[model samples]
Target chain A: MNGFGYLRPDSVHEAAEAYAAHPGARFLAGGTNLVDLLKLGVERPSTLIDIGRLPLDSVQELSDGGLRVGATVRNSDLAADPRVRDRYPALSQALLAGASAQLRNAATTGGNLLQRTRCPYFQDLDKPCNKREPGSGCGARDGVHRDHAVLGHSPQCIATHPSDMAVALAALDAQVELYSTAGTRRLPVADFYRLPGEHPERDTWIRPGELITGVRLPAATAGAPSAYRKARDRASYAFALASVAVVLRIQDGVVDQVGIAFGGLAHRPWRARHTELALLGAPATPAAFEGAVALELAHAEPLRDNAYKVPLARNLALDVLNRLAPAPAPA
Target chain B: MTSAPQPGHHSEVTLRVNGKPHTLRVDHRRVLLDLLREELDLTGSKKGCDHGQCGACTVLVDGRRLNSCLLLAVALDGSEITTVEGLGGDGDEPHPLQRAFLDRDAFQCGYCTPGQLCSALGMLAEAAAGHPSHVTGPTAPSGRPVPLDRSEIRERMSGNLCRCGAYPRIVEAIEDVIP
Candidate 1:
């Protein structure tokens, strides 16, 4: 690992100030992703602002009947939170499905949001990657790219965000809370991530020197029948080949409200907004679910050797939707 | 203001290892795995991939099992760490898990034993604390004890990899001590 200056700020304000003071400083919360990147020479921060000691490790109930999870709250704790499990069950299930138990024990919520992509080219310094080095080139475009993005990808980059939690949050309509010298603000999880248009180097819409404080889970999406299903190369301890997180409410044999998001398919969590719109007020049947899912995935532009992801993702979404609202028994 | 150190490449940290506290100056780039193995001479925790992919560097930090290689020693100031060396009873007497592993013959290489043991210890605590694994049923209530069945044990301990393919015996060993 490269030598870098380290500072453990006492408070959120101090951490933001440290970021402004050091131009190339990065906030180090869990260090699971950043430390590994440092070893690979992919992340070369001049200084590390250790925010692990910051007093942002609690999950509090909001006055609006929602939940505000602190930034540094570990993934294991978040998954095990009674409110999260009972209310936002999809989020809990997603967290449990991601990474290993050891990683979930140390990985923080804020860091998980800002984790870099797992594209092989991006991690290898020798290989040319537009996301890693802007003008270099994209080796994954022609190289080994079975895991590359199929949606919201550009010529510059074809990497996919490797976060199952973010996909669930996107479906749940969660908001990411940010703290910086310019004060605080919040962005919906769906809008926080950016598609690789030209600057694949930028992962999210977060401004420089901005520190993620917490994620807000709205009460409206809580307590509905929700599920997270992932298809991976292994039964456990592997990244998702395709995943789906769905929040559905069927009323009077019709879809009342629905939210769907897919992972391992795009640069960010592919929020099935079009599909949700199609399903709302439609009959809760297998035909409607299949049609709505097909409508949303119609825009998928899959790469070579990855056309399997399209069917995999469709099956996952259809399965999750079916589970949330099973088809009426054949009469 | 208070307890915040100056910005530098090195810092003095106090670590409680194996029930003993030791203060040392460590470089910023030094990982906890190296600190335990190189400085403290606690070589029980082996380094498999050095990256977080492998669980060979697993250790209990503040009673939670985590990859020691991914954690910087300087960042873990004043934290208690328990490694394979700290697990077991007095000289000849082994911990129940260790005894079960031996009884079941759960190893051929024994490289991943330390990590498996530490991870199992942490997994038991987590399950006992009502933390559910992926295999836990959705109807299972949170904040309640989770029954550690065979599938539960396998899912919870999936992070630790044993190349010797002694998984069945490993699961048996974990099952043997689950009372």
Candidate 2:
């Protein structure tokens, strides 16, 4: 690991000030993904503002019948929380499906959302990855493209977003509360991750000094249907090949509202607006899901290696929707 | 920005391991694995895969199991740690999982044994706390507690890799704690 100045700030304001002063500084929380990336030379911040000391680890109830999860809350803690377990099992299930017990114990919520992709080309410093270096060629485009992105990918980059929690948050319409030296701000979770269009170097829309304070869930959509299904090579501790998070409100045996996001297949958590439109007011059946997937995958440009993800995603969508059909009626 | 490799300054960190406090000055870059083995001479926490892949360095950090190699010594300040050396209560009585491993002969190379024992203890607590396993249903039946089965045990114990094909014995040792 490169030797960098490490400052453990006591408060969020101090940490934000530290980041503003040092343009090349990155906040360290749990340091599971960030440390691994730094060791691989994918990210080399001159200074590390350790924010783990900040008293920001809690799961408090919002007045709007939602949750306010502190960014520093450990993944294990948030997932194992009783309220999160029963009320919002999508988030808990997503967390449980990620990394291992040991890693989840050390991984923080803020850090998990900020984790970079696991593409082989991105991790290998020798390879030319546009996400690592803008204007540089994307080696994953031609070589080792199995885990590369198929949707929302540009010629510059085609890497998948690898966070399991972010997808669930997107489905839940969670809003990210950000604090900077100037003031505080909020961004919808859908707006947090930026699609790799022309500039793949910019993976997120977060500003230089902006600190992720908390991810707040909006008012719960009553009778909401939510499910997270991930397909992978292994049963545990492996990155996903393709996954889908579906939040549907099925009323009168039809899809009244649907929120869909795809992981391991896009630059960001690929929010399927097209699929959502197709499924709205449509019957919640296998045939309806197949058509919605078809519309979304229309723009998907799968490379030579990852054509399998197209069908993998379709089947995953169908399976999750089928399981979600029997949920809303009882509620 | 290129970060130059600068030598870290040593700080005095006091850690309570197995109910005993040990005070020592360790460099920021000194990994916890080396600190346990070299400084405190607690070699029970083995170092198999130093990159957190193998759970050989599984030690309790603030009463939770974590890979020791990935953690730095500076990170463990004010934390209560428990290693294989302290798993047995006060060193007089061996932990139930420890005795079970011995009775079952759950090791061959004896390298992955420490991590296995520590992780088993941690896994048991997690199960008892009703922490849902990835392999189990999200809504695992409410009232009657579930027993840890083969697939459940294998999925929970996947972090600790055994190279000598000793998983059978390891599973046997863990299954005794079902009651």
**Residues A37-62 of candidate 2: C-alpha lDDT, one tens digit per residue:** 76577777777788886888998999
lDDT (C-alpha) at residue A256 in model 2: 94
Q: Model 1: runs farther than 4 Å from truth?
A: A220-223, A326-331, B1-7, B89-92
- Indicate which candidate wins on DockQ: 1
Model 2 alpha-carbon miss at residue A316, Å = 0.2
TM-score of chain A of each: 0.98, 0.96
Per residue, candidate 1 scores C-alpha lDDT tens digits across B97-151 of 9999999999999999999999999999999999999999988987999999999
lDDT of 1 by residue, A222-243 (tens): 3367889999999998999999
TM values, all candidates: 0.97, 0.93
Which candidate ranks first by lDDT, i.e. highest? Answer: 1
Fnat (0 to 1) per candidate: 0.80, 0.33
lDDT (CA) for every model shown?
A: 0.92, 0.83
